[model samples]
Structure formats: C-alpha cells, structure tokens
Target: MKKKFKHIKESQLTITELMLPSHSNFSGKIHGGHILNLMDQIAFACASKHSENYCVTASVNKVDFLNPIEVGELVTLKASINYTGRTSMVVGLRVESENIRTGEKKHCNSSYFTMVAKDEAGKSAPIPGIILTTKDEIRRFARSITRQNEGRHRTSRFSSKIFKTDAYIHLLEESNSKIELK
Candidate 1:
C-alpha cells in the first residue's frame, strides 16, 4: 500500500528559461501574467508530488513583483509544498532572474498558490497531511495556517455582502456541500 503518511522534506522544483522575443512586452519587461503562469505550473508540480495526484489551483494567496526581468535574463522558478489540508495544499513559489552572461541572480517575484488534488473523475480529492521536518519548514507551515485563518475570517465577514444574492448564495451552499463530502 502507498504510505499513508509522507513528509515532503526539502521538496523543490526549478525551471529556467530565457526571456524570448515573444515573451517580452513593448516596455521590454516580462509580463506579470507570464510569471504568474509559470508560478502556477511550478506550484502544481510541487503540490502534486506531495499529494501523489493531479492538482488544480484553487487560489493564489499573494503575488508580489520585486523587480522587472530583462529580456535576455534567464527566469528561474522555484516552488515547494509548504503545507497541506484535508483536500488542499499550499505551495510557495519564488521567481528569480539570472543574467547568464554575468552569472548574477536576483529575486523578481514571490507568491503562494493553493492547489486541490483531483480524483480520477476530475473531482476534488483529499491529500495526505504534511509533516514538518525542519525549523524553517515548521515556520512556513505556521505562516500558512495563519494566512488560511485570516482568509477564512475575512471571507466569513464579507461573504454575506459578496454572496448575499440568491443565486450566489445557492452556489456557495453547493460548493460548501461538495467540500464537506471530501
């Protein structure tokens, strides 16, 4: 049987690619959307490795661009699964731009992605829990928990306004029911 308890210790995925002519904007900076797409891809890979299943992005907790990447630079995306829940996994991603010629690297962006494992039927599926091994991993896990709690509190407070409409309320209720099933 597959091990029911698995710890994602030192998990990381990295991808490097040059900023092609097609990938640049008129201003010569890489587009934020492009970076975000790469971040999502890396995050999914990390989460899936931990969950041992296909994973779909549920939400992006945050995305911040610290610097602009030049066209000739190599963009490197690094991601790892930092936390997990019954049906969700939180993956942290960082993007760095390196000048291959000069061998210089700088952090360009950082983000957190939430992914849900999927079953054979393409429905949401439960994921095994994560075991924190190192102090840094434990701290990251704690931060994820804090973020999740904050998100829940914020949603609960404003959900009545956001989903107060009858149709939206119905949809929310249906989603909640499905989540409970998993």
Candidate 2:
C-alpha cells in the first residue's frame, strides 16, 4: 500500500492550563519540570496525530527555558510536526505564559522532541511525509536536518573511544570546574 502524506498543519496542537500554587517551586515560579512534562505530552499528541499510530519519544532534542512562569499565569503550549523521517518525526514545541490580569504573554520555552511511530506489535512504523505549506514549514524541515546532522557529528566526536581527553584538557583550564586526572 502506498503511504499517505499529512500536512504540517494537520498535526498541530495547542494546550493551555492555568498555573496553580502547587505547580510552583520554592522560588515561587512554576517548576521547569512541570513545563517539560506538558511539552512532552503535546509532542506526543502532535506526533500521534500525524502518524496515525502510537508514538513514543525517541529523543528529546534541546529545551531552553527563557522566562519564568508565575503561579497565576496561564501556560500555553503549541506543538507541530517539524520534520518526518521513515519512522520518526521531530515535534517542535513552544511554551508561553500569559498574565491573566494584565493580558500579557511571554515566551517561556522552546524545544524539539523526536518521536517514533509504533505499530501494534511494538515495532517502529513508517510515518507519513510532511506536506510543507508555508515558508516557515520549509525552513523548519531544513533546520531539522541540520540539527540532526549536528547531533550525530557531536555524538561521534565525543564517543568513548574516539574522544581525546588530552586535546580538550587545555581548553578547560579557563573554566571554573576542577578536573583531577588519574
């Protein structure tokens, strides 16, 4: 059977939740872990929507927290399929927080999650190709390829066997970390 293609917009998802006091940390800000948990959920939803199968998180790419979310704020998470491979798709998620009283919003975080479609037998299943409808969609697809390549290069460079501790030791001299070599 020929594989079906899905548009990037078809899998887009948005979720908003009011932050509560219980969600805050000791510093009176919403805990980063809480936000991450929400992002993961949205990523799963978006990936599953596109794949039409059970999806699992293959990897979580980068997550950068920009602003702190307050207890009284409304946190919103938007997710979409950025890129699709044979069986994996990168789910891009953005988190924003809104102050209900002032009606102001701030970007809280942005992250990318790699999700793999799964079949009933718990094997990886092929995912549909993404239909890029906008310039941003094209840019995202290209960026995803670059990001994946960079990650692979970094991993290969730092692998246990290939890594050169001696070459990097000198570069760490200016840092605060104290390294004791045996």
Candidate 3:
C-alpha cells in the first residue's frame, strides 16, 4: 500500500471550558492536574483524528504552568500535530485562559504529547505523514526532530550504566547543595 499524507489542520482540535470552583486548588486557582487531563484528552483526540485509529500517549514533553487560571475564566486549548513518524505523532497543545468579565487573556501552558497509534491487536500502527505547506508548519516539524534528538542525547548522557558521577559532581558545587562523599 502507498503511504498517506495529511495536512495538520485536517485533525486540529480546539476546546474551551469554563473553569469551575471545583477545579480549583486550595489556593483558589484552577488545578494544574485538571488542565493536564484536558490536554491529554485533546492530544488523544487530535492523534486519533489524524491517524484514523486508536491512539495512546507515549510521553508528555515539557509542561510548565506559566499562568494561574482562576475560577470563572474560560480556558481554551488548541491541539495540532507538529510531527509525524512512522507510528507516532507529536501533538502540540496551547492553553490560554480568558477572563469572562474583562476579556483579558493569558497564556497558561504549552505542552507536547507524543502519541502512538494502535492496531486492533494493540501493536504500533503506521500513521499518515504530514504535509507542510507553510513555513510555520515546517518549523514545528523541524523543532520536533531536534527535540527528539536532544532527548536521546540527554538520556544517554545520564544513563546509569555509563554515567560518570565525577564528571557531574563538580557542576553541583556551584549550586545550593552540599557534597559529602562516603
């Protein structure tokens, strides 16, 4: 069979929900966990739509809560496929919160979720490649490739099997830490 290609916008998804008091933490801000759950759901939806198959999250990249969402705000999340491998895709998510009364908007989070399509037998399945027609789409694809390469390099450098403690111990001296060798 020939390989299939799709445009990123074909499967793009956007969802908006009102922040409720129940979703807030003790400090009265919307809980980070709640936002994360919504992000994961959108990621799954986007990936599934793009692949036309059931998908599961393989990993979640950096998630930093840049702004606190308050109760009564409208939280909107947008998801799009940034990169597509043979069996996996990177779903880019952007989260923003808007004050319903004042109409002020703030960026809350940006995250990347890696999802893999699954076959009926629960094995990895091939997914369609993405068509990059615009410069922004090309940049996102290239960024995903760079991120994956950096992750591999970081993992290998810190792998327990070959990691050298001495090489990193000196670096910790500059931080707020005390080194006591046994």
Candidate 4:
C-alpha cells in the first residue's frame, strides 16, 4: 500500500544556516546568489527526505526578496516539500534573518523550487506522491500544479521557437563544441 503524506509540522525540520563573511558581498547584505544557494540546499534536503532519493534542482519558479540580511545576522533557511509530480517535486522555502544577540527576526525571502530525483544512471526518476492532509496544503498544491503546467507550456513554445532560429542553433552548436573540447 502507498503511504499517505501527513501534514508536515514546522517542527519536522530544523532551520539551516549559511554563514556569510563581510567579503561575500560589497553591499554588506547577503547576496541574492548566496541566499539562493542556501535555499537550494534546504530544498534538496526536504525533497530527499520526502522522496528518499537523490534530488536535484530543476528550476526556481519564483523568488521574492522581502528584506535584506545583514552580515552578522544568522541566515536561517526553512523548506518543505509542498507538491510532487511523476518526475518533479516543488519545494517551498522561506528564508529569515535573526540577530543572535537581540533575538529579532525578519523574513528575508521566499521561493519555490522544482526538483527532480535521479536514478543511478542519472535519468529522471519518479518520486513518491504527495497527499494533501490539510485544506491549506490542498490549496497550495493546486496552485503549484497550475503554475507548473503554465510554465511547461511556455517552455515548450519557447524551445520550439528557439529550435527554428538558425542563430540560436549556431549558438548552441558553438557552446557544444566548447564543451566537447573541454
């Protein structure tokens, strides 16, 4: 029998931290790339735990940075597997910054990441299905499915158009040659 997904409580995963040095950025705030890297790590961890497989980030649907994280603040990344597809999983991540001394916390960013599990040969692998155990989770899952379908349609159209353009094909060939030589 297939196991049903239980509503994941906040206590399921601990907040993960990625420290940043002053030299990590010029603006004295945590860089967006740094935060994204942290988010990716957290997302992969959540997805792997949910699916029990090696998962890789396929795409980041959206990222909204609400506040800046200062150099000395602890950047905490929390993530959970919100939805799953045949070969894809959407993980929701929220990043917060907290002052170690004062205990003040602020929401720094939020993002949705799509990950794909891989098999031993690196092919796309099926992931365990997700069950909506709550009304909120059901709503969120529906939204994610809608968004993923829209994105897939858009990507398909874009790829078709790109394939019909000689310039793009030439660029792709050039890039491929560079990779081959390397």
Candidate 2 deviant stretches above 4 angstroms: none
Per-residue lDDT over 1-182 for candidate 3, one digit per residue giving the tens place of the 0 to 100 score: 99999999999999999999999999999999999999999999999999999999999999999999999999999999999999999999999999999999999999999999999999999999999999999999999999999999999999999999989887897899987779
Query: Which 10 consecutive positions of candidate 1 have the poorest summed lDDT?
Result: 173-182
Model 1 spans with C-alpha error above 4 angstroms: 1-3, 160-182
- Tell me the tens digit of each residue's lDDT in model 1 across 45-108: 8888888889999999877799999888999998888888888988988899998899999999
lDDT of each: 0.84, 0.94, 0.98, 0.77
**TM-score for each model:** 0.82, 0.97, 0.98, 0.76
Model 2, 1-182: lDDT tens digits are 99789888888999999999999999999999999899989999999999999999989987888998999999999999999999999999999999999999999888899999999999999989999989999999999999999999999999999999987888988998998669
TM-score, structure 2 vs. true: 0.97
lDDT of 3 at 22: 98
Ranking by lDDT: 3, 2, 1, 4
Instruction: Name the Cα RMSD for model 2.
Output: 0.9
| Residue pair clashes in candidate 1 | none
Kindly indicate the candidate among 2 and 4 with the higher TM-score.
2
TM-score leader: 3
